[model samples]
Target: MLFFLPDAAAAVRAYARLLRPGGRLVLSTFTEVTDADKEWFQHLGAALGPYLPASPEPAPGSPPPPEARLRTQQSLADVLTDGGFSDLRFAEIAHRTVFARPEQFWDWLWSAGMRGMMESIAPQDHDAVRTALTALVAERLRAADGTLGWTTSIRFTTARRP
Candidate 1:
C-alpha cells in the first residue's frame, strides 16, 4: 500500500495500522542531523526577509520553521518499536534539492505547491529577498551548469511487523 504521512509520530502508528501480515512500508523523511539543513534554511530566510523572522517561536512543542524536529535517526527507530514495528531498516538517501538562479528558486517555491506559506511577505520585500537570494545562490553553489549545489538531509527507513 502507498501512504504518505507528514506527521512523523502518527506516520509510525499508521504504518502498523495497515500492512497485512507481511507488508512493506517505504518511509522517507528528514533526519535530525541529515546534513546541511541549516544552510538550506539560511538560504530560504535570506530570500524571505522579515517574513522569515529573526528567531522562531522558542518553545518545546512544535518545531521551528526550517529546523523541525527531525533530530536523530535512532529516535525514529525507537518510535517504530513503540509502534509495534519490527525488522527495521534505515538508509541515508540524498534528497538535497538545490536551485541555481532566483527564478529557479521562485519557480520551485511557487509551482511546487510550497509557495502558499511564503505569501505573507510583502511583494517588494519578496522581490528584494529574491534578488539577494540570486546572489547568495550564485556565491554558494557554483556548478558547471551555473546552478547552485546543496545537500539536503533525508533519512529513508523501512520497517515491517511480523
Candidate 2:
C-alpha cells in the first residue's frame, strides 16, 4: 500500500515513531507489472481517455510518484534508513492470476481495485467501454487453452526500529 501514499517518506517516519525500540516493521509494495498487465492498463487508459478528467501535472520540484520513489530494494532501504530503521530485509514474490474467459476477467476487474476506474465512466458509456475492453482482452490475453493470465512482482520489506 506504500505505493498508494502521497508522501511515503512521511508515512514511513510515522510508522517508525509508532513502533517501540527493536520493533519490526513489515510492508509490501508492487515492484513490477507484467507485460500483459501493462497492455491491459494501456488499453483501459485509451478507452477511458475521452471520458475521464485529465490528470493534473505535478508542481515544479515536487517529489516523484510514490511507486517510483520506492520502486527498488535500494530505494526502499534508503527510505527506511532515513526513517531511522535498521536490520532491513527484503523478499520478492511473484503471483499469477488466471481467468477462464474474457467475461470472467471483466468480472474480476469489477470485483477488484479496478472497479473504481470502471465506475468513473458514465452509465451511458459502460457498454462501450465493456465492448472495447472485452474485445482487447479476447485478442491479447486469451491463450491456446482458453485462459487469461497476468503476473505481478511484489516486494516485502522488514525493518527494525532502533
Candidate 3:
C-alpha cells in the first residue's frame, strides 16, 4: 500500500501516469466535518456578522482552514476514476486535534483561512463570543496541559486500477 498526504490528488494523478498496471493509490485527508468544534465557529460567525461572507470565519490570531478540498465518497470515486484509478473505497472517521488553550485554537483558525470568514463578525459581539469561547474551552475541551482539543473528521480513501 502506498500512503500520501494532501496534494495527494495531484500526486495520485502523477503516479497514475508512471505506475505499472495494477498499482494502487491509497490516501485520505482532513475534512470540514472535523470541525466538531462547530459551536466555537458558530460563535465566531455570530460575532463577525458583517466582516465575513455568508460563510463562517475564525477569530483573529487563529489559523484558517486548509485549502484542500473535502470530498464526499462519491466525489472521491469520481476523482479516482478521472485519474484513471478504479475500485475505490472510502471511510470517514472522527479524529481529535488538540490545542493547549483557547489562544492556540484561535491561532490555528487565523492561519487557516477560517479567520477571513470570521472577520465579518460585528465588533460589538467579539467580546461576548470571545468570553463564551474561553469558557467553553475551560469547561469542557481543555487537556491536562490546558490546551483545547477539538474533533476534526478525516476520510481515508483508497483505490486501485489496472
Candidate 4:
C-alpha cells in the first residue's frame, strides 16, 4: 500500500507520529522481478496494447516510484530513519507459481493484480484477449513438461518508532 502512495515519506512520518515510542511498523513492497518476468510483461504489454489503457509518462524531475525508491534495504532504511524510525530490519519472501496449462496461467492473471488490466478489455474482447494471452504463454513460457512458472519477490520491512 505504501508503494501506491504519492508521498511515502509523508505517510511514514505520519505513521511514526501516530505510534507510541518503541512501536513497530511492518510493511511489504514488491522487489524487482526476474529478467524472464520482465520479458514476459513486455510481450504482454505489446499484445494487449490495443485493449489496455495507455500509461502516461512521469514528468521530468519527478520523484521516483515508491517501489523503486524502496526496492533495496539501504534505500528503505534511509526513508525509515528520516521518518524517525530505528532498528530497521528487512527480509525477502519469494514465491514461484507454476500453472499446468496456459489457460490456468490466464486464470491466475485475472485472479491477481493483473485483473485491472484484464477488466480494461471490452467484455466482448475478453475471449479474444484470453485466447491471444494463452497462445503467447504457451509459446514463450511453457516448459518441456508443459507448465508455466514465474517467480515473484516481496520485501518486508520492519521499523521501530523511537
Which candidate has the highest lDDT of all?
Answer: 4
In the range 1-162, model 3's lDDT, one tens digit per residue, is: 122344546756887888788887777665543354567657555544544446456689653334434445665676678778988777788877777667566557667646765566576776665665567566667667666687667778777867
Clash-forming residue pairs, model 4: none
lDDT of 3: 0.64
TM-score of every candidate relative to the true structure? 0.72, 0.82, 0.56, 0.83
lDDT of 1 at 89: 85
lDDT, residue 109, model 2: 76
Candidate 1 clashing pairs, residues 3+ apart or interchain: 32-70, 32-71, 32-72, 96-152
- Please list the residue runs of candidate 4 whose C-alpha ends up more than 4 Å from where it truly belongs after superposition: 63-69, 143-146
Query: lDDT values of the candidates?
Result: 0.64, 0.79, 0.64, 0.83
lDDT of 2 by residue, 1-162 (tens): 876788778989999999999999998877755666678778867866887766799999987865566778888898899988999999998877787766666678789767776677788987777777677778877668777866668789999999
Q: How do the candidates rank by TM-score, highest first? A: 4, 2, 1, 3
Q: How accurate locally is residue 124 in candidate 4, as Cα lDDT from 0 to 100?
A: 86
lDDT: worst 10-residue window of model 4: 65-74
Prediction 3 TM-score vs. true: 0.56
Model 4 Cα lDDT, one tens digit per residue, 48-139:
88877777899999988654666777777877899999998888988778988788877898898778778878888888888888888888
